[model samples]
Target: MGLKSSQIKQLERLYRRKIAPKSVISSQLVKDLCTAAFELGRIVGLLVNRRGSVENVILGDATRLYLPDIGRIRASSQRLRGLRLIVAKPKKKQRLKAKSNMVFRPSLYEIDHDFIVDLEKLRLDLVLQIQAHVEAESKKASLAIIADKGTKVEYFRDVNNISFDFSQFIAELEAKITSQIKKAHKIALIKGERGAAILIGVYLKTQKAWKYSLNELKELCVAAKVTVVDTEVQRRLKLDAKTVVGQGKLEDICLSALHKGAQTIIFDCDLSPSQLNSITDLTDLKVLDRTMLILDIFAKRAVSRAGKLQVELAQLKYSLPRLAKKQTGLSRLTGGIGGQGPGETKLEVDRRRAKDKVAKIEGEIETLKRQRRLRSSKRHEKKIPTIAIVGYTNAGKSTLLNALTNSKVLAKNELFATLDPTARRLRFPKEHEVILTDTVGFIRDLPKGLINAFRATLEELKDADLLLHVVDATDQQYVKHSKIVEDLLGDLKLLEQKRVIALNKCDLVDSEIAHKKAKMLGGTCISAKSRSGFKDLMAMCSQALWPKDIFR
Candidate 1:
């Protein structure tokens, strides 16, 4: 970063030099560039527009070149940035001396993979790198451009001999890229409206559950209508304080996302506000963490006014900390005359508005809670036993409810398909009826804010005369899934409530295996889709809810 005044002036002069647009660079200019970098013993970079005018000059350490922010151009767009990068790095003599004994002579240098990533991520027209050496014969150069598959790289043995019509080459390259993009677009049209995403996971060295976490994250993305293109994982003793993934890894991910035409990056774990800001600052790709993805799904799936309010409250509370980032020009004095209040900064005003909105939503939810309580009281007066359906998300809870009550409640095979609690009357042959309520499903590491926001809805579980715990028999981690649900119930102080475990989706598993698993968990095997074992499930529920009616 340190440069003498003369060196600074030399770099400033680069902006004044113009070359013919048809040529990549004149041999004399290349010599001058190499000479400057060789003298400075650092990497030098130039951002050149298509018209052959230098826009910016960058300096980096001996090993790498750090380009400045080039503005937010969507990487997935079918266009190229009207710019190219030319970089030159000084070759060290000690390395050459160490390899002097080799029978075959080594070339000066090769292009860095990071630069190729930069080329694709920035959608640059092309990238050229020159290895500057003191001896003219040892100097070499490399050129890279976007190709049909990924990137096409070509090396020049001697920098002086490099010659190409830059304008024609770039025009042809862009044409090919446009054709490829058109083909890709037609394919995507047939695939429905789903955005592409990359999944990222950062875990401590001691953590071995990352695979399951990522698997669930992928499911969450699918539920949110996002198509996952690839995944990245890192193991660290401790996560980076700023970006959860280290800076280098974050850059690599951004580049990979660009390469795959992914529009979003989803982290498997929840991110702190500062971490989110830090990561977003490094790339323009849309960034989301697990909590945000879940909140988005809830916002989409909520069908009732109360459900919508609860989700909005949770999102507002979750984003309250993110608004702490400083905002410019919000601190202007608004009280021109006798207004007695201290003018609030824009940041303070934004936080105040968010807090007020959250309070308003919470108040509305309270009103809904009272309405529910009134209805609950009327049911209490009727002396009907309340049975609430609860289980891990996508575990056939809604399907089971529909199978039992014959009511249409938007049963889908996606996570959080039903957000609002649905109630139906289950009448028995003996004139005994129970209030069956289908509540929202739970997941592992469910956001705490969501839990607190849905308190009014979940409170119904406390009043539940019996809890119908449904388990997905096909899940390999069903035991762990059950434990997560139980732990959440324990947190809500509903663990002591009477419970009946029903292993749903038994038809999908082997009959013997399903029965064995049901026996092991002290539950009944039933297929919510096929009605198999429903009799046994109902018998167990009746025994728990009305022990005296078990003989009936």
Candidate 2:
């Protein structure tokens, strides 16, 4: 006789108590089983007694088992005795047949002895069987419930409940499944110290210089106090505009980031608003690009009011375009009193506020610029020539300034360590006096917003009598770095100013290489920490900033 719904429920309860605990049965498996049973219109279950014997095989459909090959074997003597084998039958007319041309039968000998079925394997086999049958009949995949281990039984109860709302159940099931997947792939918070981040980059196979850029990005992250736990790189002929890296490559990165418990992802190149949003959506981590990292370091190091204003302006300008709209389903729309105007998204409100703040800060900065121009005029009136030290970030510009003037400035091995301009009185040989000013360091691909915001500080360079371009002698890309700084100075229209090169950190490189670099850069090599070549550097500076007549 066909098993009724109540009997099938009893079988499920028995399976949960016996087979599920002994095997790797999950809620998904249970849901798949129920779905397959419902679609086939009949489920077959094997009821095995406690003594490991086949008892009774029950089918949801009342079809009789036909085993012509193994005429009814004696149930008492068969090895399958006391064990139940259940198979769901389709409500339609098609019959079930194994590959061996054997029609399914409830008889024990009809089952293959070669197959040693466990709960997990049995569940998979049943699912495959039902899927094949349904696909052949309907030509479409079946929708199955997915639940957690703790909630599978409750879900089944809800499905069977007289007042069950199938739509509500499906909605809750989908949400639960999504939440479970996200939880499985969720990034863990770093335990102590700074949060860990994954650094990712894309490069061309022919571009051997990509490592240098990635290294610079790592240094920038360090400056911002982020721990780079791992780095991923993909060599592609062309970059993917949507995600920066190829979809597969990005998936690998996301998996690695999850494994490493990283909370952020840092890209070597600046990402566009869409690209940034896409990557963030895929990875579910805080995404930062090179420009943002540099801006963050500047924000942290900015001390003076003018310096803070400039950093804030740059940050706002950079972030204004990257704001993403909130999902409507996740947000409430309000048009009542004290609410944002009608039809305006929270993202729009944020962007508007940022724009207003940018405008206000720009006005304040303009006032500061006038005050700075007046101060420069006063310095010029005193006939005190100024020497502005400039170079690629962390090239030891501030260190050189401190070494030459014997004054303390926050000199670190990090990039963009100094944001505020500091000028010290430097007396050269023969009583030649000049003001040596250390301006903010330059970097490759410096954001345009930062340059515009710091125009007042960079104005010191335009008024300088001579430029002391500090170069890190130990840097492998020192030549490239020198060119970048020169190009930027040219852009600032300070290329016409007289300049002297101070190749600092000479002690970190070979003497031969240092000499060659100094000759190539047309600068004097000096170890700022050791003060090895200061006398020559000072002599060169005095000669460039002050004429022989001034010395006399």
Candidate 3:
């Protein structure tokens, strides 16, 4: 088993070529700056929609319940509106010589050619054997590498180029090279509200957050420091795998990720564990599907007792089924906090124990739910017209809730800052008291685990008389945010309830921009930090929920 010089092998090399080489190009500063900018864009792509390809399965016209790259697509468009996402598909055609087979016999001089004829059969057999070998060799395989922990573990890698070893390079990088080709994500087809596709890494500048109307969503990313690659409303695409805007677009995402040295990818749509694993297996990067990102946000934003428990519950539930197909690295729960517990290893170690723990958590969550139910009953008895602040995560709902009531809710500039519901009674202009409840911030992709765990808390919104749908007016993809909230609300049957879109974070955008966005979204613009337009917003809510008799 030796390599011959005739074979050509591509090795992964760290190209240190100066961005603008002094020999041919000019200033190194420009080169360095441009290189830095390029790197920043690449990193943003990796952070935002790390999964280069997206394939969504729309369960209903209102919301995308299933995405191969993401688990769920919460099109939070209040009343849904007329958002049409067209996904173009290539026309299929049938081939003429479809099941053709051939039988060949060598022709030669009768007697003299007998030996040559036999030789031809030998050649044919050898060709068949070689074809089988090549096919077998092309399949994916695993590689063992020694990590910094001094632990030797086998990581799955593509099997390409393994059969013909290039002793010139180490096996690991070679494995990565093959793996990238086979599985490396190139085009991250992320969808915004309305099934709009956003390919961040390939086209959009990753360094910048989603701006314009997307400010609200952008702020969430900035607050969470989560990268935003791209957001789109795709109309047509493949249903089977769901990766790529299409095959060609997928190729582009893979190429883009490869060019920028991105080892991770994301999709706006939430993906199932199997979908996630399959994508990761193809892209060779840590695929952070939409649900994973939302979970990450929840993990980062969770603060209270119930919040932590709910987050843990959701994480465990979302994580369990995906357990069947996890990366080897995902199994190790050697660390703390996020990956501290049994983790991917738990699936390998003792699945029954993990299952038992999930059940125990469910039981505990039920107890919590009962407590929330008791609280809801109290509110019901009071007959108070409760106003629940609900909208896309990081839409300044927390900040506004804090400003209005001075309740000091954790209004950090982060996504999903308030996972648990917090309520406070506030006096209106007429001395009428109403309970303002801040529930979990909604996102385009909310994991089922989280929804299930936080049901007790979310039930607040269901019973509420009015919903304060906060929108970050400054974010570029605000429309997308609005849609996510709408879809989730619809899923909860809250859209039929009275609601007002409180466009928060108006300070980030100019008056002109704010005015237009407000008009388009049918939401009033205000900044919680500046305490601007609070009066009008309050009046709007009071007017919507309060009766003329109460005011009189």
Candidate 4:
């Protein structure tokens, strides 16, 4: 996801410390930071208002915490004093009692930043006497990149104070940032107190997902049930974490989370356990990484009992290694994509209980697998040729399956529609029956851990007599998608298997044009949505899997 140890150390040599800014913070960092912030805002519509710090950003809802950038100390327009020690506001329940000892987390983004101003204790009386200023609205401040623009300088304002649209502000922010750091090639992302869940934007594709790529990653957050009050992306976003964005941007994310009432910050990229803890410490919000989101979707779509158990087992194994980070907020951790676990603290005995539970579940799955195999063997004994449909997520494999066999599988325009291997028997006109199985979708750079975990399920593909490689015709990234699937199949050691590439969504493109593409590539073309080319696809399947001698 980032610089190798030696390379990072070389960078440290230039800066003289690990926390010092490196070349990585200048190029892609701001973009990634904006993404995280947008995601945070989407999940929780909080604000990174000026109320957070003295003329700086404060992120809190029922609880308010202070934050400064994690980098070098720099002079600010705001005033500071020696006596102004940060403290949490008194709760309604605690107003009658003395305020207890509590820890207040300041900003970690500006780790190099701290104030050494001198002020008398009398100043604390004046400030703390009022408790804290209740800001009707936070200040929306503008930052000039006399320095680095990749740093999404934080400011808050009352919504009534601003006249301009937030999106325009973000576009201009990117322009100003890039213009400031024209020489720097890398970007830096500093979210939360520390940079967490950051990832490099490989191959700067202007388009994302389908051809229409989102300039704002906050869109993913909105999709994940987060809200968006405001977002600003500085140019030169840095990729510090493989999953989370940056620190400066994370403040905005926290702000958005508060605004939208989102308790969980789900990253599009996966976060390691260490990184997860680091971000949570800063934001005090549950952090769900990219893998967790995928797993969550799996958990939701798992209708079959075996499918649910398999996903649960994989999720438990994935979470167990990460239990060390989940100390104070284990009960608060709800089952998002990443939070699939027993919610039990691991005492010495708890570990044994978990291990025993895992073994017992595995034994049950083994029994279930035997039952599945018996059914497969019965089908195999009858020699009803089987075909497995496999492709990148949302490539319309389920739609194709539904169209081909008249089965009622949920055919949504979403990813991972089919988790279980759904098969229905289809009899060819020549009196030959074939079994069609719909399996999980593939993606680029699928993790080795998940691949190993889903091995039992994926092995179902290995027994197939033919592979129906479905490609989304409407996808401009089909070339890259095709390569990813090919690489996965090669890794699965099924590269030599006989397969037919079914270019689905032909209705989206002109049939003549799609068929021309198919003919040129020597593949089948069909529009599962429109049924424009389904007959040709079926004929090809029958020709590929069955002999003509029986009908003749």
Full ranking by TM-score: 1, 2, 4, 3
Q: Give the TM-score of candidate 1.
A: 0.89
Residue 524 lDDT (model 2): 92
Q: Which stretches of candidate 4 lie over 4 Å from their true place?
A: 1-238, 241-246, 325-352, 547-552
Q: Write the per-residue lDDT of candidate 2 for residues 282-398, one digit (tens) a residue.
A: 655678988988898899999999999999999999999888855545334555677653555677668779999999999999999999999999999999889899999999988
User: Could you list the CA RMSD of all candidates, in the order they appear?
Assistant: 3.4, 14.2, 20.4, 18.9
Give each model a TM-score. 0.89, 0.68, 0.52, 0.58
Q: Which stretches of candidate 3 lie over 4 Å from their true place?
A: 1-275, 278-285, 325-350, 382-384, 507-523, 550-552
Q: Give me the displacement of residue 275 in model 2, in angstroms.
A: 1.0
Candidate 3 lDDT at 190 equals 31
lDDT of 1 by residue, 204-273 (tens): 7445488878888888887888877789989988989999888988987876666566778999888999
Those runs of model 1 whose alpha carbons end farther than 4 Å from true positions after fitting are: 1-17, 35-45, 56-76, 94-105, 112-121, 133-139, 148-151, 178-191, 205-208, 327-342
Backbone clash pairs for candidate 1 read: 330-346
lDDT score, candidate 4: 0.53
TM-score of candidate 2 versus the correct structure, residues matched by position: 0.68
Cα deviation at 288, candidate 4, in Å, is 1.4
Q: On residues 1-552, what C-alpha lDDT tens digit does candidate 4 reach at each position?
A: 243675334323322211111111111222222222232221111112112212222223333333334332211112112112222222123343444685443221120111101011011101110112223122122221111311232222321232434334434644553443332211212221111222222222333442232222343333233333333333334455622556656755654443233345655455787767677666655677556756666777788878877777778777766665435545544444786665445443355566777788788778887887788899889888899999988889998888778889878776676778788877777567888899889876565656766666777777888899999888777778888898998888898887888888887888788888777657888888777676667777777776454332
* Local distance difference test values of all predictions, in order: 0.85, 0.67, 0.52, 0.53
